[model samples]
Target: MLSGMKVGKNFWNGAEWYLTSWRSADDPSPGPYRRALDTSGLPDNIVWEGDAKTYRAGPWNGRWFSGIPEVLTYTNVMEYEMVISPRETTYSYITKPGGPLTYIVLLDTGVVRRLVWDADARAWQTYFQGPRDVCDTYRKCGAFGLCDAGAASTSFCGCLRGFSPASPAAWDSRDTSGGCRRNVKLDCGGDGATTDGFLLLRAVKLPDAHNVSVDRSTTLEECRARCLANCSCLAYAAADIRDGDVRSGCAMWTDEIVDVRYVDHGQDLYLRLAKSELPPPSSPQAFPTAPVVGGSVAVVVVIVLVLVLIVIRRRRGSTISGKLQPCLSLLSFFFFFSSFQFLRLLITAAYANIHSTLDVPGARSCALSFPCIEHQLSPAHSVTSSSAPAPIVPYVDLLTLREATGYFSESNIIGRGGFGVVYEGRIPDGRKVAVKRIIQSPLLDEGGEAFMREVEVMSKLKHGNLVQLLSYCKDGNERILVYEYMKNKSLDLYIFGEDPKLRDLLNWERRLEIIRGVAKGVAYLHGLNEEVIHRDLKPSNILLDDNWKPKIADFGTAKLFVVDQTNPTLVQTAGYTAPEYITERYLTLKCDVYSFGVMLLEIVSGRKNRNTPTLLSDAWESWNQHRITELLDSAVAQPEPELLFELDRCVQIGLLCVQQSPNDRPTICAVVTMLNNSSSQIRAPKRLVFDAMTEPRLREADHSAKEGASSTSNGSHTIYLS
Candidate 1:
């Protein structure tokens, strides 16, 4: 909505806020790189390389953009506004009064950034930037193609419903730019005779709108009618997606749709397709066929005949009981036959359910419902495994990844761990990311598959406090995972490495924030439909972004399980492992709760739990002695008396998470509630005792190495069985 642009959404539904990069700092001429606020169906931030889109911030939800949850977390300092009226629709950013001066700029290199002035440092700190990871890249999978960060397939893209790639050879080569061609073309005749039906694509960024038309006066139903009336209209959607019942206004696309992607909190988009294009009905043979009908009639007739015979026997009244016996046998046989048919139907339904859960091509493996839609809908989730495909977690090309990392040059190396090495790299679009190349060996084939599956699981995960698995790479003999780069790196460097510069950066308030952030992340994971257990929850696995916001990373060893299900996988680090995990070879969400408690203690004491086994014990004793301040990290500035109470409460909660029995430990949900509500009271924990067997496992911890570590381990590690 800049003054000179003369652009307004009222006149042009496709009007957008464009940002052009200059050739140089002093040059005013536009460069090849540009960014735009796509205000078509829904507003999404997009960056472009010339005319080709390179990145997209998935659509604006009620609170924040669907793709960027971090901004929602830091909303206190900044506010985003989107105003739609009869004359204009505009999107703008506002900084809180007396807050840091911030600028949103599109760099010449095709990277879009949000920067804030830091007066203390006298530098502009990058608050946020994109394309953050491979998933953010626009048209990454091509037109009518779906890109899923959660896909397990080597390639990230897949054709949309009723479509196939236009060029299979190009797709096989991992080049999907040719997009897709319809398997069944629309049956909307020019005379208004149409047999085309709309397919619901849930949780998706609406396709490009250059060829779309808008009519704000119409309701969604009216919009549908209009599209149905016009044979040329390919699709239609509500122009404004708000949170109430009166979601009216219309936007229709008529030409080729491109750059469609699936994301959490995305808008529902309806794609027009012929009936033939739709998947065969779930109950293909629900209606009675001629044979079935005939058989059913025959069974009914036989039952009637048997009843008639029984009546005649009763009328005859000669040994009625004996005559009835024969009729009863016939009735029993008929009932059995009916029961058998019913059981067969039940078995068929079960098979269909399982098939829908896995092989079914849908927007999500599970059911999804939108507020705007009356019923749930499912489209192609992602291309995955042949047997049991989970949702797609897109894979990066090895050559592309190699170019990003400068062919694994030493200078690009940023981290080393049990998983592999992490390198800092920029994709072709100039977006910085972290690339993790899993160490390959003859012994790691199974491990690589496990890692890939775990990445798929993690890619489905989205939270402000959790590190995002944007995309991954699985070339022959190489496995690489691309993630949103954390500028501050792992938490261990600040807490355990005795780096005064790093340690001093975290004050009492910041430390508490980090602790709460991690707790929230763990709670989110635990709250998922299938609860996740972070088997290796330690300081090294916790990362900090530029804003000092903590994000939980490394899910390679994590376990996904349903509530009340029992898993006997003893996957954990030595010091943080719950006692039950080692002794009984049992695992549960409580195991993660215990690890979080240990991490909480470490963050507070600024020491490794292994080195200080008595940290929890000391905390418990100090809480009772009313001298908990003594347990706080001495290196950090002492908390004021008022803050000491909150610190004591946190320590008590930590103790609750690390109690002896699994049942004694608090659920992650309860921990989050406790952290959020300082006034809330917690139950007293049992007397603290460091597990006796924990110390002996320290050698194992050293051997496995930990995630987010900058060092490698010496020996092969044990794989936990789920």
Candidate 2:
């Protein structure tokens, strides 16, 4: 049933007809070849074989089959009509006040029978049946071919006034599958314009209409003229099948004709033939005729593009040098595509309005990072636009992310922290990166405050040992901060791993390098006149690169050790937190120094200070006993007295920084200079009393958890102690 059609039991609606197959054998279940009123195309009843064209009732015109001298009786009992438009098509029938309801059905095979129940017979009586014999084979004669069901003992097939058998042998054997062959092939010279003509095929089931066009607006004369204008047109049918079924205009077919059947009720299919082969058209009678939305052509095109980009990213994302780059891109596309568009429009419009002296890399091209003008379309890693390194760093945008972790996708997730996750990202095309995304809330005021402080600090603080903050974003609540990715990750990877040889990655020489690098970063942070202190420093926070350079990260919990200021005290983790700060809320640069000392000890001994085992405790106790060699990492295996002295000095410094007094320990700068100068004299730290090392005193070290600090995705967050 096409779109809109009145349905009822006597009418045998689509549902009723469809369900008949489930009825019992005695119940007279209808067959599978579905029969329904095809309100579309001219409007007639058509039987279909699961989307395959089986047969059709050529539409009703005002008169008879136009070919079959019948259907004039149609008005005697009922009124039938059809309406066609670009939007939809429908065929409807209504009978007089006391008239009977009518319906059509396809039998077990392909036979079409129009049945009108007889009150006298007490059974369904067929009013009409079509294509009853072999001669009724649909479109047996093919395009321009006609069939007569009443032929005497022989298949009645003949050409419509024109056209010849496409295959002569097949025709002799009665294999009409040869269809109707053209007498002459079209000569569509180079010129697109050409002339064509049509032979009227009547009383036909029409041709295989898989490909055809219908137009009801034109007259029969106009239809002929239009057919003549196109060289490729193969056939045409009445625009409306209701009139004479003669076809008001023409349903044109430019493709091969198929599925033609002889029907008592069929329409004229005007088949195009060579001008020389067509009979003169004195009269207009032509027997015969002729995303469904979201992902339409346009939407499909975008999805295709998105898939292509994702593929490219996957390939490039897995590169060892840039693991997370591709993954980041997918993530960005999923979450930030729309946000990016808005941001892009914002930047595109703002480009000309702003002026600054800072020589940003490809400045003019830097619209929120897309940098249309300066944007370099890199085919690979090398041969980027020729330009010296620019000193200016602009605010980071989503595109900069693509250049970073390749775009922060799955392959780029270097590590998953308790809070947010860590992604290996890149900055611009050449820079490698680590992007850390925070997965917690921002209502605590810590996120924004810490972020701004980081940018302001990273903006001016430059040191080889500190992780560099490339940029930040507040897309929705999606807070992302990008930094340079360290190739070797952090110290815990090598020191805590089961592989004894893993420590080889951090040999004594590399360890010293990391120590110095960390000292330098700490020194740089403390050097700020405003004084920035890393309140939550730990070994994991210290990342190591391929060159064994140490860079400190995770500033979410860092505190500003202002020279003279006071508010929301009790900063820093208990274990690495300075004793004075933990006991008295005395935040200072010395707090970080203490944490750094603890980290240095971990690096040297391969043991966590807070979870010290008997070996560690005994080793430290033996340190003062001059048994330092016993305290060296088992992975290190062997150590010289000089290395022992170095470890001892670091341990002493760490213990000194953790002293119960705020004024005793060295500042970050002093510690850096102290650790760097080989010949410089450094005071040995005073050992604490027995009570300090007792179990009871060490049990109260859950300040961070007790204070309920909002853990960041990176396992870093500030603990507010009001």
Top-scoring candidate (lDDT): 1
Stretches of candidate 1 off by over 4 Å are 1-31, 38-44, 58-78, 83-89, 96-103, 114-129, 280-722
Q: lDDT of all the models against the reference?
A: 0.67, 0.53
lDDT tens digits, residue span 1-722, model 2: 22124322222233422212213334565545665545433344555666755555454343332222333454566654443333333344556556656675445555554556556434444444443334434455666555543221134566555567777788888766666766677645555455455554444555644436666568877767666676667667665544432546566677776655444345556666656665443222322111112213334555566666568766776454255556556655754555455455445434422321011111222222221111232111111122652243356766666556655678888866433678876554766767777666433244465555545555444556677766676554556677777888977788767788887667765676677668767765665455666777887788887777788887533333222346445344445666555445666677687677667777777776667734234534555444556666778757543344456555555555544455666776666544543222344444443122442353355455445554642011111111
For model 2, what is the alpha-carbon lDDT of residue 31? 45
TM-score (C-alpha, index-matched) for candidate 2: 0.39
* Worst 10-residue lDDT window, candidate 2: 713-722
lDDT of 1 by residue, 11-46 (tens): 445444578888866687998887766666655677
Clashes of each: 9, 46
lDDT of 2: 0.53
